[model samples]
Target chain A: MVRSGPYDLNVHCIPESGDTIEEVVAVARRLGYSGIAITNPDSMKQLPFSGNVEGFDILSGVEIRADNASKLHGIVGKYRNKVDIIAVSGGSESINRAAVENPGVDLLVNLNIAQDSGFNHVLAKEASENRVAISFDLGDLIHLKGGSRVQAVTNCRKNLLLIRKYNVPYVLTSNARSCFDMRAPRELAALAALFGMSGEEAMAGLTTIPHSIIARSRPPAGYISEGVQLVYNEADTGNIDEGDR
Target chain B: MKLLPPTLRARTRYLAFEVISQDPVRREDLIRELFSSAGSLLGDVGASECAIRLLAFEGSTGVIRCAHDRTDRTRAVLASISTVKGTRVIIHVLGISGTVRGATIKYLAGVDVFNPKDSHI
Candidate 1:
């Protein structure tokens, strides 16, 4: 069973032009976001201090456009600091290579291509073999040209089935490019229904999976307050965080 | 290619504009007149190809909002405007909106605006 809430794992806040990091942070804070995963291709220098921000847990992450593997993969936390997750930014060969090379990192496969293409099987096998966790994003499926909502739902069901069968880990996200593009938890659940996922399964994608990934990356000291713990506690029990969990 | 519906189709209707004029000495005067006159006119009478809305004119630059539906048409309209009197005109075409702002800058003060194949709409 997975928990449910407003869990947004992928968000890009970098400005279009001259806007600075402070401005970006200010905008994010004003939006009342729970967590923000900063994704700058080159470096994480511009990200605000993760601990300082209020009402949000700032996760350190990066989206690298790797040509050697010809794919985009996000590496969260520093290399020396055991990476929590490695999300596939939609490319097969490169993503596979990154997963294989980075033994400890979990895999977040962006199912951007055809389901019949066998990429899912390959990813499952690789994740199991490497003892790495895995998750998938539905944004790519929705964005595909001539792709139908039914097809997207079917693809997600197939992917989730594979995860269950292979005993691999999984998560869900909107793959948002900007702050305004963020979707509410209910919206994500509705999207899951399009992919043949039950309301519970969809809720898990938003809560449990993301919380699990964050748990893996957290330092020994733990988070700032009991409120954070309450969120995770409710998530573990697959309950809603309406009040104080 | 198959034609998409209005919701999915990227058209000229969604364009928003920002114009910057960098002449510091005439900035305030140009802005006041621009807002009171040209800005009001545009707000009242929308163009066929674009609904021009004056954003801000700071220093010698004035910002205006324009449609991004058709690049060719947008460029054509921008090209027809010759002089900004003495101010340099900088046009910024915003791509994706919200938390992430994707914009492409163009100097309409001089030179012909050319669309590159790799440019994002």
Candidate 2:
């Protein structure tokens, strides 16, 4: 948490994916990443890694996959307090809209699978207000080839335009399933450039946005909400901001 | 045939990279995949402009030479390469240098020194 890290916010590890969490963390550390979140899809049974790994931050996260909007809300509430971050797997139009509109969601992933940019002006505006980050999976650029690759790139370009227009927060993730699937921050930035994202913007997505998402999940002792918090004086009792409450 | 002057030649940058795979990868297989990756990603003309060449390969580590201005393109080319001859591989770039010796010494020789775990965040 001390580092303004080049963190990969969305990564899948053992039980859900091929590699174990230790293997994934070792590879990430070797590649110079300060931290990574192990976000296995919620539909799958997840084996929690409770103990901390020294010298590296492993933020526990859940990728909630819901068939409908109401189901999405229920899953978010169930896992909200259990994990450091919550991501919604986006595909259908309903799921994408639900994810963006929900304040509990920290990330909206896999929008590339949708027919078009499932994200649009309205969704972007909602996401901006909700502080939900749109995650662009660079793994699509690597794993997909031929026509699909072109389509994924095109979709990302369109999504990026909307994100920029609305000033929405965004993060870049490899969506890695294994140790080999993970990539360095620079390489991810290069892959990002193929879809018209500048290096600076990609770096911010990799470092700044993800860091902020993690920070937001864990506020200070007296924190209530954005811009306002509880205050306590030595001689007096603590007072919560009624407006924020 | 006459050699081109230094100023007329394309400035070269050496990229030091390590290959991570489940199986041992052959240098020949790596070379073939590198070119094909560059070709598929950047197309024929773009690949030719980058002037990519594998300078050296030993075990899992290697140094590649490309036009200095096309480092990002070259990086994309490397990143796009996920497999070689049915084996899944990830080419992780360690560092880049203006000279082959510098790349070898800085990245290949002293990899432990480059470990980010000990570095200030």
Interface RMSD, per-candidate values to 1 decimal: 16.3, 5.5
lDDT of 2 at A44: 80
Assess each model's interface with DockQ, reporting 2 decimals per model. Answer: 0.03, 0.44
Error of 1 at B11 (Å): 38
Range of the 10 consecutive residues with the lowest summed lDDT in candidate 1 chain A: A71-80
Candidate 1: regions farther than 4 A off: A1-6, A15-33, A43-49, A69-86, A113-118, A128-133, A141-145, A148-154, A222-245, B1-121
Q: lDDT tens digits, residues A1-245, model 1?
A: 11123445655566422333344344333323356555444344444334435445666554544545422323333442533234444455555556644554544445545444234676776666665545455554333323453455566777777777776666666565543233445444544554456778766766676777666666346456435653355446776657963
| Candidate 2 off by > 4 Å | A225-228, A233-245, B112-121
The fnat scores of all predictions, in order, read 0.00, 0.51
lDDT winner: 2
Candidate whose TM-score is highest: 2
lDDT of 2 by residue, A1-245 (tens): 43666989899987777777777887788788988888998988876753346778888899988999889998999999888889999988889899988899999998888558678899999999999999999898898888888889999999999999999999999999877788899999998888789999999999988888988887656677778755555347556555874
TM-score of each candidate structure, all chains considered together:
0.49, 0.92
Residue A207 of model 1: what lDDT?
69
Scored on chain A only, each candidate's TM-score is: 0.66, 0.92
Docking class of 2: acceptable
